[model samples]
Target chain A: MHSIILFAHGARDPEWARPLQRLREAVLARRPEADVRLAFLEFMTPSLPEAIDAAAAVGATDVAVVPVFLAQGGHVRRDVPAMLETACARHPALEIRLQPVLGEAQSVLDAMAEVVLAG
Target chain B: MHSIILFAHGARDPEWARPLQRLREAVLARRPEADVRLAFLEFMTPSLPEAIDAAAAVGATDVAVVPVFLAQGGHVRRDVPAMLETACARHPALEIRLQPVLGEAQSVLDAMAEVVLAG
Candidate 1:
């Protein structure tokens, strides 16, 4: 089975972490066969490298790192990739796919609309 | 004085909320004149409309809704704008500027790098 890592920009309010965790649940609900986990880009515990290590420790040979970010900003373009490079170096046996950052997906946009209207 | 609302994609872990709240604090630390607050896009409390109401209650004539999102997906392009439109309709006196989503900034990328290395 492939292990999936969802990367997010960590928040301080703790409540801010809700959506990302929900998202991880959503992804797991859809793909139960995959080992899904969450990681923070900053300001939270279990950073990406640590999360990746945990996943690897759990015997995940093939891993997909999905950035839960919204844009292709510095995190996506540089930081994420560079992190992957180091993580990959450490886990040479693991097959890693650093997926694209979550941008303006139609479903995500719809979700955002729901938030606006519901609010 | 202008009020600023930082809208985030809420997380379930609460820890996810940290970065955005910290960002708000950072903004407030620099711009004390601005009333900085936070609202979640989903799975959290004090949605955008309610947050706006709170800001309006605090007597902010001009409000800037800065999306803590990353791309121009449906949320940035459509949902957020629609929310602002409704909010504007309710508060005709409020001048709301829907700022662009945070994306691919060199600084943000740098921040991401810091997260990776530090981890």
Candidate 2:
């Protein structure tokens, strides 16, 4: 089975994870067979290593990490990859793919633009 | 006229602002007459206060600041508002409105979920 991790920069506020959790639910609601989870960079539980390692333990052959960050900031560029490197060392057999930053995605940009224009 | 500020957390990489800039352009493309711009929280130019003050100086009676952040983190909940409050004090006549965090918006959540599900 494949596992998709919606990676985000967690904050001190516990409620900050709500939207990401909602996104995971939305993804799962559409594809019940898919295994989607949340992994945080900081100030939250289940860091990237834990999330991916767990997937590896569950016999997930492939894992894709999609950063939900608005831009290619330090967290997305430096911090996430550093954590991913450690996750890789722990699970060399896991086929992990990192997706592009969400903000750069064409659809995301269009959606944000639409919202701004509507106001 | 209505001025929209697509505010975001800045990064060291100058390219990091590309998405927000694109968002501003996309907003303008659909509404040519609308005045949309980008303002950063740190590590970038045109801070929130500067952007709002400029808008107020340009005779803009109404201004909307959209936090392009993914969640209700401290930056969104505390930092942005603090900046807005000072902006309000500086320009009392300017009708400044702050929109909800982007991730909480239904359309944006849907779009992100669609991307996750597509994977």
CAPRI tier of model 2: medium
Scored by DockQ, the top model is 2
Recovery fraction of native interface contacts for candidate 1: 0.04
* Model 1 bad stretches (over 4 Å): A113-119, B1-119
Candidate 2 on B1-119: residue-level lDDT in tens?
88999898898999899888888888888889987878999999899999998898788999999988888888888888889889999999999999877767778888888877666
How far residue B100's Cα lies from its native spot in candidate 2, in Å, is 0.8
Docking outcome class, model 1? incorrect
Clash pairs, model 2 backbone: none
Q: Which residue runs does candidate 2 get wrong by more than 4 Å?
A: none
Q: Candidate 2: what is its chain A TM-score?
A: 0.93
lDDT of 1 by residue, A31-96 (tens): 567788888887787899999999999999888887876544556667888889999999999998
